[model samples]
Target chain A: MVVGFAIVAAWELVTAAGVIGFRRPIYNALALVGNMLGLAVLFLMLNAQFLFAAQVIVYAGAVMVLFVFIIALMNPESDVTLGPARGSEWMYGIVFGLIFAALLGVLLVNQGLTGRSGPFTPEVINAVGNVQSVGTALYTTFLFPVEVTSVLLLIAAVGAVYLAMRRIR
Target chain B: MPVPAYTFLLLSGALFTMGAIGFLVRRNPLVVFMCIELMLNAVNLAFAAISRYLNSLDGVVFAFLVITVAAAEVVVGIAIIVQVYRAGRQMDVDGLDLMKE
Candidate 1:
Protein backbone atom coordinates (compact mmCIF):
# COMPACT_ATOMS: atom_id res chain seq x y z
CA MET A 1 0.00 0.00 0.00
CA VAL A 2 2.76 2.41 0.87
CA VAL A 3 4.55 1.68 -2.38
CA GLY A 4 1.37 2.19 -4.37
CA PHE A 5 0.80 5.54 -2.73
CA ALA A 6 4.40 6.50 -3.44
CA ILE A 7 4.01 5.72 -7.13
CA VAL A 8 0.87 7.79 -7.30
CA ALA A 9 2.70 10.63 -5.58
CA ALA A 10 5.58 10.39 -8.04
CA TRP A 11 3.21 10.45 -10.98
CA GLU A 12 1.59 13.56 -9.60
CA LEU A 13 4.97 15.19 -9.10
CA VAL A 14 6.35 14.27 -12.53
CA THR A 15 3.43 15.63 -14.50
CA ALA A 16 2.81 18.71 -12.40
CA ALA A 17 6.44 19.87 -12.54
CA GLY A 18 6.35 19.98 -16.34
CA VAL A 19 8.61 16.96 -16.45
CA ILE A 20 6.22 15.52 -19.04
CA GLY A 21 5.94 18.22 -21.67
CA PHE A 22 3.86 17.56 -24.78
CA ARG A 23 6.95 18.19 -26.95
CA ARG A 24 7.79 14.50 -26.63
CA PRO A 25 4.56 12.68 -27.37
CA ILE A 26 6.03 9.19 -27.40
CA TYR A 27 7.76 9.56 -24.05
CA ASN A 28 4.63 11.02 -22.56
CA ALA A 29 2.65 8.10 -23.89
CA LEU A 30 5.09 5.61 -22.36
CA ALA A 31 5.00 7.36 -19.02
CA LEU A 32 1.23 7.19 -19.13
CA VAL A 33 1.46 3.48 -19.77
CA GLY A 34 3.65 2.97 -16.73
CA ASN A 35 1.23 5.00 -14.65
CA MET A 36 -1.68 2.79 -15.76
CA LEU A 37 0.27 -0.37 -14.92
CA GLY A 38 1.05 0.91 -11.45
CA LEU A 39 -2.60 1.73 -10.95
CA ALA A 40 -3.67 -1.77 -12.01
CA VAL A 41 -1.18 -3.35 -9.64
CA LEU A 42 -2.56 -1.22 -6.86
CA PHE A 43 -6.05 -2.36 -7.85
CA LEU A 44 -4.99 -5.99 -7.52
CA MET A 45 -3.58 -5.28 -4.09
CA LEU A 46 -7.02 -3.97 -3.17
CA ASN A 47 -8.57 -7.40 -3.96
CA ALA A 48 -10.23 -6.45 -7.21
CA GLN A 49 -8.67 -9.33 -9.11
CA PHE A 50 -10.97 -9.25 -12.10
CA LEU A 51 -10.72 -5.51 -12.40
CA PHE A 52 -6.95 -5.65 -12.14
CA ALA A 53 -6.70 -8.14 -14.99
CA ALA A 54 -9.04 -6.16 -17.13
CA GLN A 55 -7.07 -3.06 -16.30
CA VAL A 56 -3.90 -4.79 -17.43
CA ILE A 57 -5.28 -6.56 -20.48
CA VAL A 58 -7.67 -3.91 -21.70
CA TYR A 59 -6.05 -0.67 -20.58
CA ALA A 60 -2.32 -1.33 -20.28
CA GLY A 61 -2.14 -3.94 -23.00
CA ALA A 62 -4.61 -2.85 -25.63
CA VAL A 63 -5.44 0.82 -25.11
CA MET A 64 -1.99 2.01 -24.15
CA VAL A 65 -0.37 0.17 -27.02
CA LEU A 66 -2.83 1.77 -29.39
CA PHE A 67 -2.03 5.16 -27.94
CA VAL A 68 1.62 4.54 -28.65
CA PHE A 69 0.74 3.63 -32.19
CA ILE A 70 -0.99 6.92 -32.60
CA ILE A 71 2.15 8.64 -31.47
CA ALA A 72 4.06 6.73 -34.10
CA LEU A 73 1.56 7.73 -36.73
CA MET A 74 1.95 11.41 -36.04
CA ASN A 75 4.11 13.35 -38.53
CA PRO A 76 7.47 13.88 -36.90
CA GLU A 77 7.72 17.49 -38.01
CA SER A 78 4.66 18.64 -36.15
CA ASP A 79 5.08 20.39 -32.82
CA VAL A 80 2.62 19.54 -30.08
CA THR A 81 3.64 21.78 -27.21
CA LEU A 82 1.23 24.51 -26.23
CA GLY A 83 2.89 27.83 -25.50
CA PRO A 84 2.79 29.23 -21.98
CA ALA A 85 -0.03 31.62 -21.23
CA ARG A 86 0.75 35.28 -20.69
CA GLY A 87 0.18 37.56 -17.68
CA SER A 88 -2.91 37.26 -15.46
CA GLU A 89 -4.52 34.61 -17.66
CA TRP A 90 -2.30 31.93 -16.18
CA MET A 91 -2.99 33.14 -12.68
CA TYR A 92 -6.71 33.31 -13.41
CA GLY A 93 -6.87 29.72 -14.59
CA ILE A 94 -4.91 28.44 -11.59
CA VAL A 95 -7.11 30.43 -9.23
CA PHE A 96 -10.28 28.98 -10.67
CA GLY A 97 -8.93 25.45 -10.49
CA LEU A 98 -7.96 25.93 -6.86
CA ILE A 99 -11.40 27.29 -6.07
CA PHE A 100 -13.06 24.35 -7.74
CA ALA A 101 -10.90 21.92 -5.85
CA ALA A 102 -11.77 23.58 -2.59
CA LEU A 103 -15.48 23.46 -3.35
CA LEU A 104 -15.32 19.80 -4.23
CA GLY A 105 -13.47 19.01 -1.02
CA VAL A 106 -16.05 20.87 1.05
CA LEU A 107 -18.87 18.97 -0.62
CA LEU A 108 -17.23 15.62 0.02
CA VAL A 109 -16.47 16.37 3.66
CA ASN A 110 -20.05 17.51 4.19
CA GLN A 111 -21.38 14.40 2.48
CA GLY A 112 -19.36 12.28 4.89
CA LEU A 113 -21.39 13.81 7.71
CA THR A 114 -24.60 12.44 6.16
CA GLY A 115 -23.57 8.83 6.97
CA ARG A 116 -23.48 7.81 3.34
CA SER A 117 -19.70 7.86 3.26
CA GLY A 118 -17.90 4.68 2.26
CA PRO A 119 -14.31 3.45 2.12
CA PHE A 120 -12.20 4.21 -0.94
CA THR A 121 -8.94 2.86 0.45
CA PRO A 122 -6.34 0.30 -0.61
CA GLU A 123 -6.38 -1.96 2.47
CA VAL A 124 -10.11 -2.41 1.93
CA ILE A 125 -9.33 -3.81 -1.53
CA ASN A 126 -7.63 -7.25 -2.16
CA ALA A 127 -7.33 -10.42 -4.29
CA VAL A 128 -10.44 -12.11 -2.86
CA GLY A 129 -12.41 -10.21 -5.46
CA ASN A 130 -11.28 -12.45 -8.31
CA VAL A 131 -12.78 -13.49 -11.63
CA GLN A 132 -14.63 -16.54 -10.31
CA SER A 133 -16.52 -14.71 -7.60
CA VAL A 134 -17.25 -11.67 -9.80
CA GLY A 135 -18.74 -13.84 -12.50
CA THR A 136 -20.95 -15.67 -10.03
CA ALA A 137 -22.29 -12.37 -8.78
CA LEU A 138 -22.82 -11.09 -12.30
CA TYR A 139 -24.68 -14.19 -13.43
CA THR A 140 -26.80 -14.17 -10.35
CA THR A 141 -27.60 -10.70 -9.00
CA PHE A 142 -26.17 -8.14 -11.43
CA LEU A 143 -27.21 -9.81 -14.65
CA PHE A 144 -28.88 -6.63 -15.81
CA PRO A 145 -25.65 -4.61 -15.84
CA VAL A 146 -23.79 -7.38 -17.59
CA GLU A 147 -26.35 -7.28 -20.40
CA VAL A 148 -26.16 -3.49 -20.58
CA THR A 149 -22.39 -3.66 -20.83
CA SER A 150 -22.64 -6.08 -23.72
CA VAL A 151 -24.81 -3.63 -25.58
CA LEU A 152 -22.33 -0.87 -24.89
CA LEU A 153 -19.41 -2.93 -26.16
CA LEU A 154 -21.35 -3.77 -29.29
CA ILE A 155 -22.00 -0.10 -30.00
CA ALA A 156 -18.38 0.76 -29.41
CA ALA A 157 -17.27 -1.95 -31.82
CA VAL A 158 -19.63 -0.76 -34.53
CA GLY A 159 -18.49 2.79 -34.00
CA ALA A 160 -14.85 1.81 -34.40
CA VAL A 161 -15.56 0.01 -37.62
CA TYR A 162 -17.48 2.93 -39.01
CA LEU A 163 -14.72 5.35 -38.09
CA ALA A 164 -12.08 3.15 -39.62
CA MET A 165 -14.09 2.85 -42.80
CA ARG A 166 -14.36 6.59 -43.10
CA ARG A 167 -10.59 6.84 -42.78
CA ILE A 168 -10.09 4.29 -45.51
CA ARG A 169 -12.37 6.18 -47.87
CA MET B 1 -0.39 -5.75 14.30
CA PRO B 2 -3.45 -6.49 12.23
CA VAL B 3 -4.13 -4.58 8.98
CA PRO B 4 -6.93 -2.08 9.26
CA ALA B 5 -9.37 -1.31 6.49
CA TYR B 6 -8.60 2.38 6.88
CA THR B 7 -5.07 1.74 5.70
CA PHE B 8 -6.34 0.60 2.34
CA LEU B 9 -8.85 3.38 2.09
CA LEU B 10 -6.31 6.07 2.81
CA LEU B 11 -3.79 4.58 0.42
CA SER B 12 -6.25 4.42 -2.45
CA GLY B 13 -7.58 7.85 -1.67
CA ALA B 14 -4.13 9.41 -1.77
CA LEU B 15 -3.31 7.64 -5.03
CA PHE B 16 -6.53 8.72 -6.65
CA THR B 17 -5.94 12.30 -5.62
CA MET B 18 -2.48 12.21 -7.15
CA GLY B 19 -3.92 10.84 -10.36
CA ALA B 20 -6.52 13.58 -10.46
CA ILE B 21 -3.85 16.19 -9.98
CA GLY B 22 -1.66 14.67 -12.68
CA PHE B 23 -4.51 14.46 -15.16
CA LEU B 24 -5.49 18.06 -14.69
CA VAL B 25 -2.06 19.64 -14.54
CA ARG B 26 -0.48 17.89 -17.48
CA ARG B 27 -1.16 19.20 -20.95
CA ASN B 28 -0.15 15.87 -22.47
CA PRO B 29 -3.18 13.92 -23.59
CA LEU B 30 -1.52 10.57 -22.88
CA VAL B 31 -0.77 11.58 -19.29
CA VAL B 32 -4.34 12.73 -18.89
CA PHE B 33 -5.64 9.38 -20.06
CA MET B 34 -3.31 7.55 -17.66
CA CYS B 35 -4.51 9.69 -14.78
CA ILE B 36 -8.08 8.79 -15.61
CA GLU B 37 -7.06 5.12 -15.49
CA LEU B 38 -5.49 5.72 -12.11
CA MET B 39 -8.74 7.13 -10.84
CA LEU B 40 -10.61 4.12 -12.18
CA ASN B 41 -8.19 1.78 -10.45
CA ALA B 42 -8.84 3.58 -7.20
CA VAL B 43 -12.55 2.87 -7.54
CA ASN B 44 -11.74 -0.75 -8.23
CA LEU B 45 -9.96 -0.89 -4.91
CA ALA B 46 -13.08 0.40 -3.19
CA PHE B 47 -15.22 -2.26 -4.84
CA ALA B 48 -12.75 -4.92 -3.76
CA ALA B 49 -12.94 -3.92 -0.10
CA ILE B 50 -16.72 -4.05 -0.01
CA SER B 51 -16.71 -7.40 -1.75
CA ARG B 52 -14.28 -8.78 0.79
CA TYR B 53 -16.30 -7.53 3.73
CA LEU B 54 -19.61 -8.92 2.48
CA ASN B 55 -18.03 -12.04 0.99
CA SER B 56 -20.12 -11.21 -2.03
CA LEU B 57 -18.58 -10.52 -5.42
CA ASP B 58 -21.07 -7.90 -6.58
CA GLY B 59 -18.56 -5.10 -6.19
CA VAL B 60 -15.98 -7.03 -8.18
CA VAL B 61 -18.49 -7.51 -10.97
CA PHE B 62 -19.12 -3.80 -11.08
CA ALA B 63 -15.38 -3.14 -11.22
CA PHE B 64 -14.97 -5.59 -14.10
CA LEU B 65 -17.73 -3.87 -16.02
CA VAL B 66 -15.99 -0.57 -15.42
CA ILE B 67 -12.75 -2.01 -16.76
CA THR B 68 -14.50 -3.21 -19.91
CA VAL B 69 -15.99 0.21 -20.45
CA ALA B 70 -12.56 1.70 -19.97
CA ALA B 71 -11.23 -0.63 -22.64
CA ALA B 72 -13.85 0.56 -25.09
CA GLU B 73 -13.20 4.13 -24.16
CA VAL B 74 -9.47 3.73 -24.85
CA VAL B 75 -10.03 2.17 -28.25
CA VAL B 76 -12.17 5.05 -29.37
CA GLY B 77 -9.82 7.64 -27.93
CA ILE B 78 -6.79 6.16 -29.68
CA ALA B 79 -8.61 6.01 -33.01
CA ILE B 80 -9.47 9.65 -32.67
CA ILE B 81 -5.92 10.50 -31.70
CA VAL B 82 -4.61 8.68 -34.75
CA GLN B 83 -6.85 10.63 -37.03
CA VAL B 84 -5.98 13.85 -35.30
CA TYR B 85 -2.28 13.19 -35.66
CA ARG B 86 -2.56 12.31 -39.30
CA ALA B 87 -4.44 15.43 -40.23
CA GLY B 88 -3.05 18.14 -37.96
CA ARG B 89 0.61 17.09 -38.06
CA GLN B 90 0.66 17.79 -34.33
CA MET B 91 -0.50 15.89 -31.24
CA ASP B 92 -0.49 18.81 -28.88
CA VAL B 93 -4.00 19.43 -27.60
CA ASP B 94 -3.49 23.18 -27.96
CA GLY B 95 -2.06 23.26 -31.47
CA LEU B 96 -4.49 20.91 -33.18
CA ASP B 97 -7.15 23.52 -33.82
CA LEU B 98 -9.19 21.49 -36.32
CA MET B 99 -10.66 24.20 -38.54
CA LYS B 100 -7.75 26.59 -38.11
CA GLU B 101 -5.31 27.49 -35.33
Candidate 2:
Protein backbone atom coordinates (compact mmCIF):
# COMPACT_ATOMS: atom_id res chain seq x y z
CA MET A 1 0.00 0.00 0.00
CA VAL A 2 2.83 2.38 0.85
CA VAL A 3 4.64 1.75 -2.40
CA GLY A 4 1.46 2.08 -4.41
CA PHE A 5 0.59 5.34 -2.72
CA ALA A 6 4.06 6.70 -3.37
CA ILE A 7 3.88 5.83 -7.06
CA VAL A 8 0.45 7.36 -7.47
CA ALA A 9 1.44 10.44 -5.50
CA ALA A 10 4.47 10.99 -7.70
CA TRP A 11 2.35 10.56 -10.80
CA GLU A 12 -0.17 13.03 -9.47
CA LEU A 13 2.45 15.68 -8.71
CA VAL A 14 4.22 15.28 -12.04
CA THR A 15 1.00 15.47 -14.01
CA ALA A 16 -0.19 18.43 -11.96
CA ALA A 17 3.05 20.25 -12.71
CA GLY A 18 2.57 19.39 -16.34
CA VAL A 19 -0.88 20.93 -16.26
CA ILE A 20 0.55 24.22 -15.02
CA GLY A 21 4.00 24.27 -16.62
CA PHE A 22 3.11 23.32 -20.16
CA ARG A 23 3.09 26.22 -22.63
CA ARG A 24 0.33 24.98 -24.91
CA PRO A 25 -3.28 24.89 -23.73
CA ILE A 26 -3.78 21.51 -25.38
CA TYR A 27 -0.86 20.07 -23.47
CA ASN A 28 -2.20 21.60 -20.26
CA ALA A 29 -5.58 19.96 -20.89
CA LEU A 30 -3.92 16.63 -21.54
CA ALA A 31 -1.88 16.97 -18.36
CA LEU A 32 -5.03 17.73 -16.39
CA VAL A 33 -6.53 14.53 -17.83
CA GLY A 34 -3.59 12.60 -16.45
CA ASN A 35 -3.84 14.34 -13.07
CA MET A 36 -7.55 13.52 -12.86
CA LEU A 37 -6.84 9.88 -13.60
CA GLY A 38 -4.27 9.79 -10.82
CA LEU A 39 -6.79 11.39 -8.47
CA ALA A 40 -9.30 8.69 -9.44
CA VAL A 41 -6.77 6.10 -8.43
CA LEU A 42 -6.38 7.86 -5.08
CA PHE A 43 -10.15 7.90 -4.64
CA LEU A 44 -10.20 4.15 -5.18
CA MET A 45 -7.42 3.75 -2.67
CA LEU A 46 -9.49 5.73 -0.17
CA ASN A 47 -12.37 3.24 -0.77
CA ALA A 48 -14.49 5.83 -2.53
CA GLN A 49 -15.45 3.55 -5.36
CA PHE A 50 -18.27 5.75 -6.52
CA LEU A 51 -16.00 8.79 -6.49
CA PHE A 52 -13.43 6.83 -8.44
CA ALA A 53 -15.97 6.07 -11.11
CA ALA A 54 -17.31 9.63 -11.19
CA GLN A 55 -13.84 11.13 -11.28
CA VAL A 56 -12.81 8.86 -14.11
CA ILE A 57 -15.99 9.14 -16.13
CA VAL A 58 -17.09 12.70 -15.49
CA TYR A 59 -13.81 14.48 -14.89
CA ALA A 60 -11.33 12.61 -17.03
CA GLY A 61 -13.81 11.48 -19.66
CA ALA A 62 -16.38 14.22 -20.19
CA VAL A 63 -14.98 17.47 -18.81
CA MET A 64 -11.52 17.00 -20.27
CA VAL A 65 -13.05 16.21 -23.63
CA LEU A 66 -14.81 19.55 -23.44
CA PHE A 67 -11.54 21.29 -22.56
CA VAL A 68 -9.68 19.60 -25.39
CA PHE A 69 -12.49 20.39 -27.81
CA ILE A 70 -12.45 24.05 -26.84
CA ILE A 71 -8.69 24.16 -27.24
CA ALA A 72 -8.95 22.67 -30.68
CA LEU A 73 -11.76 25.04 -31.67
CA MET A 74 -10.04 28.17 -30.42
CA ASN A 75 -6.49 27.10 -31.23
CA PRO A 76 -5.15 29.88 -29.04
CA GLU A 77 -1.54 30.76 -29.50
CA SER A 78 1.05 29.42 -27.07
CA ASP A 79 2.51 31.44 -24.22
CA VAL A 80 4.65 33.46 -26.56
CA THR A 81 2.24 36.38 -26.60
CA LEU A 82 2.72 37.02 -22.89
CA GLY A 83 5.21 39.88 -22.87
CA PRO A 84 7.36 40.47 -19.77
CA ALA A 85 4.76 42.79 -18.37
CA ARG A 86 4.62 40.93 -15.04
CA GLY A 87 8.16 39.68 -14.72
CA SER A 88 7.99 39.45 -10.93
CA GLU A 89 4.61 37.65 -11.03
CA TRP A 90 6.25 34.26 -10.60
CA MET A 91 8.25 35.44 -7.60
CA TYR A 92 5.07 36.60 -5.92
CA GLY A 93 3.40 33.35 -6.82
CA ILE A 94 6.14 31.33 -5.19
CA VAL A 95 6.03 33.41 -2.02
CA PHE A 96 2.25 33.10 -1.77
CA GLY A 97 2.48 29.39 -2.47
CA LEU A 98 4.93 28.90 0.36
CA ILE A 99 2.69 30.82 2.75
CA PHE A 100 -0.33 28.71 1.76
CA ALA A 101 1.64 25.51 2.19
CA ALA A 102 2.82 26.57 5.61
CA LEU A 103 -0.73 27.36 6.65
CA LEU A 104 -1.94 23.96 5.49
CA GLY A 105 0.86 22.20 7.31
CA VAL A 106 0.14 24.04 10.53
CA LEU A 107 -3.55 23.36 10.30
CA LEU A 108 -3.05 19.67 9.67
CA VAL A 109 -0.50 19.24 12.39
CA ASN A 110 -2.42 21.25 14.95
CA GLN A 111 -6.12 20.50 14.56
CA GLY A 112 -6.04 17.19 12.71
CA LEU A 113 -9.29 15.23 12.15
CA THR A 114 -11.38 15.86 15.21
CA GLY A 115 -14.76 14.87 13.87
CA ARG A 116 -16.76 12.10 15.50
CA SER A 117 -16.62 8.91 13.52
CA GLY A 118 -19.66 7.81 11.55
CA PRO A 119 -21.25 4.39 11.08
CA PHE A 120 -19.84 3.58 7.67
CA THR A 121 -16.47 2.03 8.25
CA PRO A 122 -14.59 0.38 5.44
CA GLU A 123 -15.87 -3.08 6.22
CA VAL A 124 -19.43 -1.84 6.51
CA ILE A 125 -19.14 0.02 3.23
CA ASN A 126 -17.68 -3.05 1.59
CA ALA A 127 -20.60 -5.13 2.86
CA VAL A 128 -23.36 -2.69 1.90
CA GLY A 129 -21.55 -1.79 -1.33
CA ASN A 130 -19.88 1.58 -1.76
CA VAL A 131 -22.21 2.82 -4.48
CA GLN A 132 -25.39 1.75 -2.68
CA SER A 133 -24.51 3.53 0.54
CA VAL A 134 -23.47 6.66 -1.27
CA GLY A 135 -26.64 6.57 -3.36
CA THR A 136 -28.81 6.14 -0.30
CA ALA A 137 -27.16 9.12 1.34
CA LEU A 138 -27.58 11.11 -1.85
CA TYR A 139 -31.29 10.36 -2.09
CA THR A 140 -31.97 10.64 1.64
CA THR A 141 -29.75 12.88 3.73
CA PHE A 142 -28.52 14.88 0.76
CA LEU A 143 -31.69 14.99 -1.26
CA PHE A 144 -32.09 18.77 -1.08
CA PRO A 145 -28.57 19.55 -2.19
CA VAL A 146 -28.85 17.00 -4.97
CA GLU A 147 -32.03 18.64 -6.22
CA VAL A 148 -30.41 22.06 -6.06
CA THR A 149 -27.41 20.76 -7.97
CA SER A 150 -29.62 19.31 -10.66
CA VAL A 151 -31.34 22.67 -11.03
CA LEU A 152 -27.97 24.35 -11.21
CA LEU A 153 -26.88 21.98 -13.93
CA LEU A 154 -30.04 22.73 -15.90
CA ILE A 155 -29.44 26.46 -15.59
CA ALA A 156 -25.84 26.08 -16.70
CA ALA A 157 -26.88 24.09 -19.74
CA VAL A 158 -29.44 26.70 -20.73
CA GLY A 159 -26.96 29.48 -20.22
CA ALA A 160 -24.32 27.77 -22.30
CA VAL A 161 -26.81 27.15 -25.09
CA TYR A 162 -27.92 30.74 -24.98
CA LEU A 163 -24.35 31.94 -25.19
CA ALA A 164 -23.65 29.69 -28.14
CA MET A 165 -26.83 30.78 -29.92
CA ARG A 166 -25.99 34.44 -29.38
CA ARG A 167 -22.62 33.89 -31.01
CA ILE A 168 -24.28 32.18 -33.94
CA ARG A 169 -26.72 35.01 -34.54
CA MET B 1 0.19 -0.92 6.69
CA PRO B 2 -2.32 1.51 5.28
CA VAL B 3 -1.21 4.95 4.24
CA PRO B 4 -1.74 7.73 6.74
CA ALA B 5 -4.51 10.19 6.04
CA TYR B 6 -2.27 13.19 6.66
CA THR B 7 -0.21 12.22 3.66
CA PHE B 8 -3.24 12.55 1.45
CA LEU B 9 -4.08 15.89 2.96
CA LEU B 10 -0.53 17.05 2.40
CA LEU B 11 -0.60 16.02 -1.20
CA SER B 12 -3.89 17.82 -1.67
CA GLY B 13 -2.41 20.96 -0.16
CA ALA B 14 0.61 20.80 -2.40
CA LEU B 15 -1.57 20.36 -5.45
CA PHE B 16 -3.77 23.27 -4.40
CA THR B 17 -0.76 25.50 -3.94
CA MET B 18 0.55 24.55 -7.35
CA GLY B 19 -2.82 25.36 -8.86
CA ALA B 20 -2.86 28.76 -7.16
CA ILE B 21 0.60 29.52 -8.42
CA GLY B 22 -0.34 28.48 -11.90
CA PHE B 23 -3.43 30.62 -11.78
CA LEU B 24 -1.30 33.59 -10.80
CA VAL B 25 1.62 33.04 -13.15
CA ARG B 26 -0.05 31.70 -16.29
CA ARG B 27 -1.16 34.22 -18.88
CA ASN B 28 -3.57 32.20 -21.01
CA PRO B 29 -7.17 32.11 -19.87
CA LEU B 30 -7.59 28.45 -20.77
CA VAL B 31 -4.59 27.55 -18.63
CA VAL B 32 -6.07 29.62 -15.83
CA PHE B 33 -9.26 27.59 -16.14
CA MET B 34 -7.27 24.39 -16.01
CA CYS B 35 -5.53 25.63 -12.87
CA ILE B 36 -8.93 26.23 -11.31
CA GLU B 37 -9.86 22.65 -12.09
CA LEU B 38 -6.65 21.50 -10.44
CA MET B 39 -7.53 23.36 -7.24
CA LEU B 40 -11.01 21.84 -7.25
CA ASN B 41 -9.55 18.39 -7.73
CA ALA B 42 -7.21 18.96 -4.81
CA VAL B 43 -10.12 19.96 -2.60
CA ASN B 44 -11.95 16.83 -3.69
CA LEU B 45 -8.98 14.76 -2.71
CA ALA B 46 -8.90 16.32 0.74
CA PHE B 47 -12.63 15.68 1.09
CA ALA B 48 -12.28 12.03 0.19
CA ALA B 49 -9.39 11.56 2.55
CA ILE B 50 -11.20 13.20 5.45
CA SER B 51 -14.37 11.23 4.71
CA ARG B 52 -12.50 7.97 4.73
CA TYR B 53 -10.63 8.76 7.90
CA LEU B 54 -13.81 9.80 9.67
CA ASN B 55 -15.77 6.76 8.49
CA SER B 56 -18.44 8.95 6.94
CA LEU B 57 -19.99 9.27 3.51
CA ASP B 58 -20.57 13.00 3.75
CA GLY B 59 -17.20 13.90 2.29
CA VAL B 60 -17.71 11.59 -0.65
CA VAL B 61 -21.14 13.05 -1.32
CA PHE B 62 -19.74 16.56 -1.07
CA ALA B 63 -16.98 15.65 -3.47
CA PHE B 64 -19.58 14.35 -5.88
CA LEU B 65 -21.51 17.59 -5.61
CA VAL B 66 -18.30 19.50 -6.25
CA ILE B 67 -17.75 17.49 -9.41
CA THR B 68 -21.22 18.38 -10.63
CA VAL B 69 -20.70 22.06 -9.93
CA ALA B 70 -17.31 22.01 -11.61
CA ALA B 71 -18.79 20.48 -14.74
CA ALA B 72 -21.46 23.12 -14.90
CA GLU B 73 -18.95 25.86 -14.30
CA VAL B 74 -16.71 24.57 -17.05
CA VAL B 75 -19.59 24.44 -19.49
CA VAL B 76 -20.62 28.01 -18.88
CA GLY B 77 -17.07 29.28 -18.60
CA ILE B 78 -15.97 27.63 -21.83
CA ALA B 79 -19.00 28.98 -23.64
CA ILE B 80 -18.15 32.49 -22.50
CA ILE B 81 -14.52 31.96 -23.42
CA VAL B 82 -15.51 30.82 -26.87
CA GLN B 83 -17.76 33.85 -27.22
CA VAL B 84 -14.92 36.10 -26.21
CA TYR B 85 -12.59 34.43 -28.65
CA ARG B 86 -15.17 34.77 -31.42
CA ALA B 87 -15.53 38.44 -30.58
CA GLY B 88 -11.82 38.91 -31.28
CA ARG B 89 -11.06 39.93 -27.72
CA GLN B 90 -7.60 39.40 -26.30
CA MET B 91 -7.17 35.84 -25.07
CA ASP B 92 -4.88 36.78 -22.24
CA VAL B 93 -6.54 37.25 -18.87
CA ASP B 94 -4.33 40.22 -18.10
CA GLY B 95 -5.33 41.81 -21.37
CA LEU B 96 -9.09 41.32 -21.02
CA ASP B 97 -9.82 44.26 -18.72
CA LEU B 98 -12.83 45.71 -20.48
CA MET B 99 -14.84 46.01 -17.26
CA LYS B 100 -12.21 48.07 -15.48
CA GLU B 101 -13.06 51.14 -17.49
Top model by DockQ, which number?
A: 2
* List of clashing residue pairs for candidate 2: none
lDDT of 1 by residue, B10-52 (tens): 4456546655665655555655665676677666666665555
Quantify all predictions' global Cα lDDT against the true fold: 0.60, 0.92
Output the lDDT of residue A14, model 2. 99
Stretches of candidate 2 above 4 Å error?
none
**Lowest-sum lDDT 10-residue window in model 2 chain B:** B92-101
Model 1 lDDT at residue A68:
72
lDDT of 1 by residue, A19-54 (tens): 234456566666666656765665555566676777
Angstrom error at residue A34, model 2: 0.6
How high is the TM-score of chain A in model 1? 0.68
Model 1, stretches more than 4 Å misplaced? A1-23, A75-80, A86-129, A167-169, B53-56, B95-101
Q: Provide DockQ values for all models, in the order shown.
A: 0.33, 0.73
Interface RMSD of the predictions, in order shown? Answer: 5.5, 1.8
Give the 10-residue window scoring lowest on summed lDDT in candidate 1 chain B: B1-10
